[model samples]
Target: MKLKGIHHVSAITGTAAGNVDFYTKVLGMRLVKKTVNQDDTSVYHLFYGDERGNPGTELTFFEFPNAWRSRPGTSSISSVSLRVPGDAALNYWHHRFVQYEVDHDDITERAGRLTLAFRDPEGQRLMLVSDEHDTGIAGGKPWVKADVPAEYGIVGLGPVQLTVSRAERTERVLTQLMGYTKKGQYASAIAGQPDIVVYETGEGGSGTEIHLEERSDLPQERQGIGAVHHVAFRVDDEAELRAWIDRVGAAGLAHSGFVDRFYFKSLYFREASGILFELATDGPGFDTDESLDALGESLALPPFLEPHRARIEAGLRPIGTGSPS
Candidate 1:
């Protein structure tokens, strides 16, 4: 079975309120889910995505207040990229960033695509890459309440870049087991970075491209705010997910087995580079527990966590208001 694309990328954030304000108000993505992390029920697990909270569009964060700064090095996801429409959209975003007083760099070319690099309030690196092939207006569905007009808003998630100690191991896992093909490579896209090998999967839409940059000299990364927890790839259904589990076994890669996350089933494993990767099924999506209009309006818990909902809610801090309706 072929892997579909990225389901979501989870990262750590310092403050829930700051994260909510920036992602919703400044970035223009809809906060699709407001929930608690099942594994760690004390903090909030916030989700942001396109209008429908589509699998490829999801970008989630775990609230880790008082967390230290992430130590950047090899074997880490250094940046998350989003897809914008094109040059016009990029220009619009340039102006939007300036208007909102967001810290960002001017447009630049990377692997033949125009990009605007920036960081979140908590120092999470991000970029807006222009997809020349995309015909959809400003990438994809837009959140109606976003400050930027729908046409100029972000389409969805694009390529994610990883810093690895060595590309050989990770490259083998991606090409052989993950149903990905090497698309191209870029030399020195970022200063001090060596060649970056681009791997694409499943017809290659927004979240299909992954760049592996080998930096054997860099040290291992430490966990903190702005650190990426894991990068989850997508499988179409339970059957396909099972097929992947078999594939993982055949490849001799250790996995966490099937996990029921309510919205999706997950199989998490670390790649050769030590960057955590997850194979997540795409069925029974975010809307299963809540209606489209009222999603992220209240806290949601899985069946197991439902019993302690009151206790969990009490421990978590309140999410700020004035978010996208």
Candidate 2:
């Protein structure tokens, strides 16, 4: 199958309001939509990303007010590394994190770039790597205008590393099923460090990846707020998505039936080894609500939810991606 790229990355979260605020105000992500969890109505599902909350740029969250914390283990995939522009951009973000008191780590060079480590409301380890090769696709905070040069802004998602106990199951799905070939060892995860072995979609680093590290010492990861809910790879359309579904079924694995997610169609399934996986179609994007110039100002709903707009709107908790309460 021809997987285009990463559609989006979703994670679990606790305080829905607080989580929304952090991604928007603190991280400068635009809140594109607000909706109650389709499966669990009391909770929320918030989306944050660049202008219009474009695909790949999105960082989605699911609210679980009183949920157990999942232990970080070798079984699940976590840690999404965002590809930022350069070392100078890293410095700008470092000061910004301090201003917001978000508790981010100091600058360090690793894996051939400068990176800053930090946590969300739920202790999911997330980082920003300074990369010079971006396609100039980015969105900033409302108050923070475009200051740094285009080269310093975020380009795309860098690499998504999964901490798995064993790589056999996931590796088979990656190399044999998907079209990722084995690339060699990654360098120290610090700035000015060597590059690590990277397996990408045909072209290196352009698509979603399964960066594996075997760790016997680490325990299995629990599905808690702040933990990754799933990693979605892009498909050309619904047909391609169905093909992937067929492949998973043929492999004799269980999967969540296909569901319409408005911007893109999606299906969920756990890899044989571990880690929640999603195949998303990359069309009918975020332009449905508002426009390229004005997005996230109003609530957006999928077609099914539109019929019950009154009830849906009333039931949904009012929140934005900025100004944490």
Candidate 3:
């Protein structure tokens, strides 16, 4: 079975309010889900995406107050990228970033596409790539309240850059185990910057890439605020997920087998260079709990956590976005 594309990228954040403001107000993504981290109920697990909170559209964060800041180096997801519609969309974002005083770089081309790079308030590195040819995961509706019009709104995920100690083992895991095919290669325009090797899903665009940058001399990355914890890849269903479970078991890789995430089923594993990866299914989407119009309006708890909802609600710091519809 072929892996569909990227499901979501989960990262760490220090303040839930900062996460909400930057993602919703500046980036214009809808805060589709406001839930607590299932494993740690006190912290918030915020999900941002296009209108429906579709699988490939998600960029999630776990907000742990007073956490250590992430120090970037090797074996970490260095940056998360989002896909926008075209050159016009890129221009619109450039103006928006300027108006909001968001730190950003001038538009640049990589892999033959225009990109606008920037950072979130929490110091998470992010970019907006103009993918006019990406029809794969472009179907999500834009948020109604977004400052930018729906026509020029951000669509879904783009290529994610991961810094690694060695590229060979990571390349094998991506190709042989994860089903990504090498697409292209480019040396950074800046001297001493590691060469970027592009890998795409079988589908080949939008939310379907793992760009490996080899920095063998750098120290291992430590995860905290502003760090990407894991990258989740999409599979079609349990049938496809089962195929992966079998494959990872046969390969003797460390993996979390079939975790029922309520909204989706998850299978997590780490690559040879210690980059965390997950295989996730696309069914039972974010609409499972809330209606399309009312998503992210209230806190949502999984069934098992329902009994402890009172304690969980009391513990989480209030995220004061007031219905991110």
Over 1-325, each residue of candidate 1 has an lDDT whose tens digit, in order, gives 8777777999999899889899989889998898888888998899998887888888999998978999888889988998876778889888878888888998988877888998787788899988776422233487888887887777788889989887889988899878789888888655776798888888775568898888867799987998899999988888888788888888887888888899999888888888899998876988998999977888888788888887887787776654322
Task: Rank all candidate structures by their TM-score, best first, as comma-separated numbers.
Answer: 3, 1, 2
- Provide TM-scores for the models: 0.94, 0.86, 0.96
Better of 1 and 2 by lDDT: 1
Summed backbone clashes in each candidate are 1, 17, 0
- Residue 263 Cα positional deviation in candidate 2, in Å, after optimal superposition: 1.6
Cα TM-score of candidate 1: 0.94
> After superposing candidate 1, which stretches have Cα over 4 Å from the reference?
134-139, 190-193, 321-325
lDDT of 2 by residue, 77-116 (tens): 6688766656788888888778777768988765545688
Worst 10 residues of 2 by lDDT: 135-144
All-Cα superposition RMSD per candidate: 2.5, 4.2, 1.9
The whole-model C-alpha lDDT of candidate 2 against the native structure comes to 0.68
Which structure among the candidates has the greatest lDDT?
3
